[model samples]
Each structure stands twice: as structure tokens, then as C-alpha cells.
Target: MDKSYDPFKYSSDSLEDVAEQISDVLKCPITIEDVNHRLLAYSTHSDSTDPARISTIIGRRVPEKVIHSLWKDGTIPALLKSQEPIHVKNIKEVGLGNRVAISIWKNNEVLGFIWAQEINKSLTSNELDLLKKAANAVQNKLLYLQKGKMKKEEREQEFFWKLLTGNTLRHDDMADGFYQLNKTMPPIYSVVLFRFTKPITEKMEKQLNYLLETTQLVHICLVTIDYNELILLVSPKEEQPLNQIKQFLRVMEKQMMQRYNIEHFAMSIGGIYSDISSVHIAYKEALAVLKVKERYLSDAEHLMSFSELGIYQYLDVLAEKRKHNRSPNYPLSQLEKYDNEHHSNLIETLETFIDSDSNVKTAAKQLNVHVNTLNYRLKRIQEITGLDLKNVNEKFSILLEIKIRNMGL
Candidate 1:
């Protein structure tokens, strides 16, 4: 081995060339990935390649489970923290073989990683130094690719915002932007929003972009950041879009919480639309669902769409009317006062009754109380408020007022 060897001095004009060069020097299989585990390049390999490498190359990105395993085992974290090569023993459970990897870095940030599978030999200290050299050689090429990607991303963001804000009236009008970007609009899409408690950091953005780009389960048409919110235009490929979105949300929520210890973000989606022109409505609806979750966090916890809000969907309109008329909810106020003074739960019983669709048995079961107990409470409720329990209008009004009071509006 040359003592003063330089990666740049080798015959390499592209990342693929760098990969093949590294593989030739190390006599092993080689693969390269961006910071998000999306495969960028790999060297021609023999039959000695492991299942993990085969999966990554086939999918053109690392599988989620493999990525999860690497993160959980502390290998990925260590690689991110240093430019030095990390020797990883085979994690047979995740189909990983013995390998050595190093992060490609430009400055303080990691641009990507290069992996050399040790099929038959372990890398000596000098070879470890050689792997580090490979990382250095791969850096500038990755940066050039990244610069082009970022500019395309910026244009997509601009065009998306214009569509969302209703600047582009029809799909036909966006033909030029679509052609210039070399992207196709989804035939069907929904506006999905994730609200974070704090503004997203650059690291978090990279993680999110990685997830969206690498995952095939959910089709993300476009994504952008607005303050503390990460907005995505999701294209559900399944025949039933709602089920697809629900599954996507479950997976994303689990991933964000598990991988990043991120639990502060909540996900919501608007009605699925067939045309881009309806996206403004979808955007508004998504924002509405977000507001519902903000005001009634516990009650709206599982509700991801506007329709799921049920009677609470009219909270904004009700609130608007109250501002003008200022009519106090007399019956609900009386019940709340009685419950407070008696150390009772008359208010809960009433709300539970309404939520159970006025079913005494269901309401009693939900409250973990006896049917007679719930009935007696109902009798007492009617007595205190002098309110008719059979009135549909009255029942809805009570539930609406309770939700409003719960929101402190």
C-alpha cells in the first residue's frame, strides 16, 4: 500500500467510480448511501454479498428494519459522530454481515456513508485509514449532487405553495411548472399536516425527508415546512385512501417516536381530492383538524380528519355565533356547578351519554358504572337543569356547550 495514498489521486470522476476503486483496493463488496440511507452507488459484486447488501441494492435504499437495527445497535450513531471507520460485527437478526463503514463528511455535517463488507478478511488499521480516504473522495461528488437536489427542492416548494395558496387555478395551468420539474402530479392526493411543538431543526428535517423519500408504503407528492408544522401532500395509491393514510400515520408516528425520540408532533389529514384545484380546500380542512387537536387534545387525539370531528366540527361556527349573541349555556353550567359542589361526576355522565349516542347501557359500560347508577344520575341531571332528556336539539346543544367549555372558549 502506498504510504501517502490519496483518494483524489486515484482514477475517479464519479461516486460509482469511487465505489469500484474502494472495492478493488479492499477486495470486498462496496455500497454508498446518503445520510438518509438512500442508496447512491455500489460496486459490482460477486456471490459473496450478504442478504442485507442484496436487499439494499434491490430496493435502491436500505430497508427500514435494517436501518432500525443499525440505529438500535449504536452503529449508525457512532458513524454519524466520527469520520473514523466503524467495524460492525454481523447482526444476523437483521441480515447484516461483518462490515466496516465510514461517514462521508464535508464539514461538521455528515453527507453520507460508505460500507465495505468484510466477506473473508478483516480490514487492517491501514485499510481502515484507506476507508476513511474513500469517504473523503466521495464527499465532493455527493455535494455536487446535493446542490442540484436542493435547487430542485426549492422550486418544488415554491410551486407547491402556490398551488396550496390557490395561485394556480387549474391543473392545466401548472403544466409548465410540472414539465420543467420533470415531476408528475398524483391523480389523487390529500393534504397531510404534522404539527410540532417546536420549530423543526435541520437534523429533524433530514430525517423526515429521508423517511418520505425512502418509504414506498406511502406516496408523498410534496412536502414543505411552515414554522413548527411539516406539511405533506400525500398521494395514497390504494383504492381506499383513508385506510392507507391511517396506516401511514401509524408507521410514521411509531418511527418518529422510536428513531428520534420525537413525540411532540401530531398528524392530521384533509379530505382526499381528485384534482389539485381542490387542494386549497384540503389545506384548509387539514388546518381545521389541527386546530381541533390543539383545542381538544385528548378528545381529538384519534381523530385525523374533519369528518371525524362529528359535532365538534362546528366549534368554530358555534364560537363565531356566540361572539355575536353571547348566550350562556344555562343547563350545562348548572350541571357543572352541581358536580363541583357535590364532588360528583354529573358532567361526565352527561357527556358520556351523548357520546354513546344516548345509549344507557353503552354509556354505563363506558363509565364503568352500573346501569341503574347511570339512570339515576340521568334523572338527577334532568331534575337539576329542568331539561328534557328526549329533546335531540337539547342533547346536541349540551354536548356542544360542554366541548366549548372544555376548550375554555
Candidate 2:
């Protein structure tokens, strides 16, 4: 091959022809992949090759472990940042051989990658320079593909808004829209939301997209951005979408913190559903969870789904109804009034006793007092309020009232 001749000087109709041309020039195997590591094309090679490339060619996507290894080893971060050809050392654990790769880029965004596997010798400095030129040429090749993707994203965003707003006419249309844009209507999915401390910038949005595209934990069907909210329609990559959603949240959180030192964000999800029409409900539930977190920031910090809210789900209604009442229904007023006069913890004792389900020993342990002393406090509480500790209904009502007061209702 003449060093003066550019392998990618002329245009090809498809990436496969380009890959073959690169392989023929460099005297090594070549593979082409999209930004997400989905195999777009690979050249026919009879030379020594690694299992990772073989698996990727067969599966049509890079295996999860190889992607993980690249991320962990800083190979992916280098590829994302640099335009020059990168030399990656062999990683035997994932069956990844030595390779020279370069990111195909447009306007500072990576469009795809071209990898040249080293079968025998290392890529010469000239070969690396040639690889960079090929990446530049491939950028032009990918321009048409990228424009098509951007147009498709515009359409998907419109349909996502319709799904969330319940503006669509029927489930069939919803399924058809999903099939058209995202390839398949997911069997099960959940609405997940992440609210940042501030409005997301274009740069942050790009980072989020990179993170989402690179993750294999969830099948992200649709994504849209509000002022500060990153909304997603996601289904499981493995099984049981609920747990998968939580796992994805954790991954996103870790990535954001590691990459950008981003700390101010909260994530939540709605109940998983099979029907595409129920996206509106899921979106609402996810919003409700975020609202609940804002109100009860400490208590609901670990709340992942609306169903997990349990009794807190309806607390607003109960609080509202109590707002109009003229008198306290479970008036612990006597206990309150007695504690104020004597400077005793009688109200605390009473609340603890109720919380413990009238279990004297448990309440005593919680209050850091002896069982006999707790019995004495219980006696005093019953005497002061004329309360019967044995009545289950009364105790339950008192607990509910206590919650309402604690919430400042």
C-alpha cells in the first residue's frame, strides 16, 4: 500500500465498505460501531482476532462486560475526549486485544468509532495518523446518519409529550408510535424522573445523554427534558423493571458524581406497567413521589415508588379534613398540658407507647428507661388523659393524629 494514498479519501455508500477499505490499508482487522457500541459494520478477517470483537459482531452490540471494562480502564473516557487515535492495550479478561481506535466526531460530539485490532505488531505512528484521517472522513460519512437521527429524535420528543399528556387517541397508536421511533413497544416499563438542583445546561444534557446511551441496565425508550427534570420511559434490560429502575438510578447517581462532581439531584419512579396508555399515570405518580420527597425530605429520601409510600399516600386528604375540624379528635392535650406544668416527658412516653403498639418493654427500650419505670409512665399517662392503653382503635387514631401534627397540619 502506498503511504501517499488515503484509504478514506473517496466516499463509500456504506460503513461496511469503508471498514473493508481501512482493513485492507492497515493490514489488520477493522470494526465500526456507533457511539453506544452497537456494531454497525466489520470487515471480513481471517487473521487472529479476540473473542470480544467476535461476540460484538455476532451480538450486534458490545457485550456489557467489555463496555464496563473500557469505562473502568479509562479507555472510553479517552475516546470521548480525544480526537487523535488511541492505543488500547490488550485486556485479556474480556478477550479484548490490542487496538488503535479513534472517535468520529462532529461539533464536539462523538458520532461513532473506528477500531483497528493489532493482530501481530503495534500500529505505527503513520498508521495512527491514517486512523485519525479515517475518523475525520467517517465523520462526514456519519453526517447523513446523524441528521436522520436528529430528525427522528424530534419526532420521538413530540410523541413522548403526547404520551405524557394523554393527548393520543388510542393504545394502538401509542404502540405504533413506540414501534416507529424506539423499535419496539416495551412489554413492561416505568416512568423515572431525575430532578437536578438547577436547570440543565446543553452541556449537562449531552453528558446525561452519553450516560443514558452507554448504560445497558435499562432500555431507555424515550427521554425528554423539562426545566430541571430529566424524564424517561425505561424498561428492564434484565427482569423485574422495578428493581432494575432502582439499580439504574444508582448507576446514574454514581456516574454523575464521578464525572461532574454533581451532587444535587433526586431520583424517583412510578409503578411499573405493561400498558403503554398508562404512561400518564406513571408520570403523575413519579411527580407525586418527587413532591412527597420535597415535603417530607428526610422521611421520603429512600422512597423509590409511589406504592412504597404506604399510609403517607393519603396523608394529605386526612390532613385537609382535619384542618376544618374545630377540636382535636385524639386530644393528647391532658398529656401535653401535664408535661408543660411538671416538665415531664409524659407526652413523649405516650407517643412512644402508642408507636410501640402498647408494648411497654419496647417503648421503654426506645425511651432509654427501665420497663418498670415505663410502666409507671404508662400508668401516669392513662391517669392524666383517662386513656385505656388496651383499646386498639383509640391507639390507632391517636397515632394518625400524631402524624398529622408532626407534619404541621
How many clashing pairs does model 1 include? 0
Q: After superposition, how far is residue 35 of candidate 1 from its true place, in Å?
A: 1.2
Pairs with backbone N, CA or C atoms under 3 Å apart (clashes), candidate 2: none
Q: For candidate 2, report its TM-score.
A: 0.87
Worst 10 residues of 1 by lDDT: 3-12
Supply every candidate's count of residue pairs whose N, Cα or C atoms clash at under 3 angstroms. 0, 0
TM-score of each: 0.89, 0.87
Q: Per-residue alpha-carbon lDDT of model 1 for 1-409, expressed as tens digits?
A: 7868865566577778888888988889899999888899999999878899999999898987888788889998898898899989899998899999999999898998999999888999888888887887888889998999899999989988987899999678776677778978778889989999899999889878867876667778788999888998898985988889888888888878876788878888899888778888899999999888888889888899866878668887887787787667799879888988999999889999998999999999999999999999999999999888899998988888888778776
Consecutive 10-residue window with the lowest summed lDDT within model 2: 328-337
